[model samples]
Target: MKFLFLITFIHILPQCSGNPLSRHHTTSEEIKREIARYSDIAKAIINLAVYGNAQNRSYERLARFVDTIGPRLSGSKNLEMAIKYIFNALQEDGLENVHLEPVKVPHWERGVESAMMLAPRSYNISILGLGSSVATPPEGITAEVLVVTSFDELHKRAQDAKGKIVVYNQPYISYEETVKYRLLGAVEAGKVGAVASLIRSVTSFSINSPHTGLQKYQFDVPKIPTACISVEDAEMMARVASRGTKIVVTLKMGAKTYPDATSFNTVAEIVGSKYPEQVVLVSGHLDSWDVGQGAMDDGGGAFISWEALSLIKELGLRPKRTLRLVLWTAEEQGGVGAQQYYQLHKVNISNYDIVMESDEGTFTPMGLAFTGSDKARAILKEIMQLLQPINVTNIYENGGGTDIDFWVRDGVPGASLYDDISKYFWFHHSQGDTMTVQDPSQMNLCAAVWTVISYVIADMEERLPR
Candidate 1:
């Protein structure tokens, strides 16, 4: 870490006295002109990723990866294989400093699970046990159902919730808002004395598909069987309850949590030509829930990050600062791998010029969501102008990286790719997140956006103001 800062110092010393990157000495005009000078570099990156040999490369790579590795849940053998696969690919690609960082991650398995409606006419319900959920007894939990729309409503009728299975049929306002139920439904249900919880899938549109995600068990409350049911099943129970009909359901699950398993974050980089210690980071998570192929959730994001480095390497463009690609593990389990990486790397946080992530689906490219000082934003906006050929230059404020959030919160500039995610939640965390949902042309556009922005920033005259 000291070497990184020393390299930056040595590289900047000769030009430091009149350095154009000085926020205090340099005016906005200088920043704009300096950023404008990179237009040619950006255009080259865009052309190569979108129209040249690299076009559609990310899509093909992702398809092949997901088809082979399949779903890679945290602490699972599949995830380990996926990590080894990526490590080998990085080494084969001849990327610099390809290595792995070990971290302990939670290992939770979803064993055979089933739910059946026993009252108000027998019916079978499609269900997915939430991550880390406790299993129902061998005989299963059979009881009347208490349907509620929101936490407030559940609390209002807490007395009736006792000794029943609570079904949350909350409307899908948005993933950010609706996901709370999936994350906390079990705890709330347990608090109200419910034996089990059946949360409505956190999706806007579902065709009898149930989405599963990580949920927490509050040690203060008793652990109960928790799972997500299809939107159709949830609504049907609500309608039946509204009609004054009693609903009884039997829930059985064999889910279990074992001791933490060792996992690794796959890492590779393009070493800098000048300031090898200074770094610009790009990333995506490699692990996903054990559903579908996990392609849409993060396979698209991860491959595109790798593609960015590949594009720059093929173009013979060498940035002054190291451009590192980190394929995070256990991101689905609340960024466990990233948290550990942060702990190991934050000591040299000053050397991190910028951090970029692309966890959201790599659909059609829009622009970028940035988190940094106004001066940095101004520089980035001009830098983005180089992408006019592809028309993905807009910058929003709400988008940043989950894995890189720690660094951003600690005052480093951060970036996340902004794209069309109108239908992202529809397949998120569900069995529908397969490779079939990916489009080659769209992946090409997204890779273009990611490559241009990341390459330009790394090779810029000065790092963005922090």
Candidate 2:
């Protein structure tokens, strides 16, 4: 069945070679030989990283860094230290052009914040102020609660939300779908004159822990204090409100945003042996929320990206095109670092061969999500087959990371590591994102997958079609 699937896929998909005008060179025989050679090398790299001395060390290094640095919120000193740490580590590893590119990032500090259920049996609720949220009045606001699941419901019951605290008890269908509430809860609630808002944490399951994330308030709308509450608390409020019991809550917060501060996106590269100016880039965001150690959220992503280059350099392998590692800062505040990097490099965008990012947790390797033309996709399909030994053969289209969105829009092929995120959202922006959730074997496998794909793509005779 697998063989039949492969044969059918190949026949249906277009092929690409060194140049689009010279497609005749991408015949099956040549592709097969290329696949065989690269597959052997990739398998060897995977085995060396997973079963050899490199095993477990990647996770250990990441744990130590994250534990030592703690949370690396944008514009914080911790973030700068993390960048310096990676920059020095890359230099010590002998990678070339190890440097930091400047980017001014927003500085949001979460001061003392708390929420309490005042009626229907007093209960202290776990909460974390959403990023960029306004603080409640000095004494805080105590008001009856308005419970709604969806934005449509919020609109329908807009009249009832006036002078009340809107509590969004939305279900966690998926991160992409559920996060909409967290991102726009304040704007939606404020539009209806809500004094404050609390959103159900964006996670399938929670342990009475609230998750904090970035939320934006529309300029035209009134800005209101917003925070996330644990799933249990959200559901309990919803049940109480259903019974027509007035749910009163007191919300107090000291969240504040200051002037943008200077930060950096750390970059290091392994120069190519042949196409020196051409580049294959692998990246991950470095800045994270103030909560937790930021380990799984992005420390894992950034370190695994670093480990890819580290392993390649250690093994004494140089590809045809340069391999660049980018640890973007201020990503938690809406890709500020990445946007600046894109604007600065937009003129030379064509020089980028491919850009890959690993922002998801470094869980077991499930393959990659790709964004490119059909010809490029075909090449990727062939490349993914080499990862089959680790059960990472999946590759879908129209996928990449937030940091690479601008480049992908500019017609550059982009990719993001796909992993089993079944439990990622649970700890994602919460205090649960410590190093305890990481697995050493999975980290090594993630590094191996990233290394092989990047090396093979950089060494390929042609860049992926734009």
Q: Estimate each model's TM-score.
A: 0.95, 0.95
Inter-residue clash pairs, candidate 1: none
Each model's lDDT comes to 0.88, 0.87
What C-alpha lDDT, on a 0 to 100 scale, does residue 127 get in candidate 1? 96
Candidate 2 positional error at 421, Å? 1.0
Which regions of candidate 1 fall more than 4 Å away from where they truly are? 1-24
lDDT: worst 10-residue window of model 2: 1-10
Per-prediction CA RMSD (Å): 5.4, 2.8
Per-residue lDDT of model 2, residues 76-194, tens digit only: 88988988888788888798999999989999998999998889888999999999999988899999999999999999999999999999999888888789999999999999999
What is candidate 2's TM-score against the reference? 0.95
lDDT of 1 by residue, 250-270 (tens): 999999999999999899999
**Candidate 2 off by > 4 Å:** 1-24
Instruction: Single out the weakest 10-residue window by summed lDDT for candidate 1.
Output: 1-10
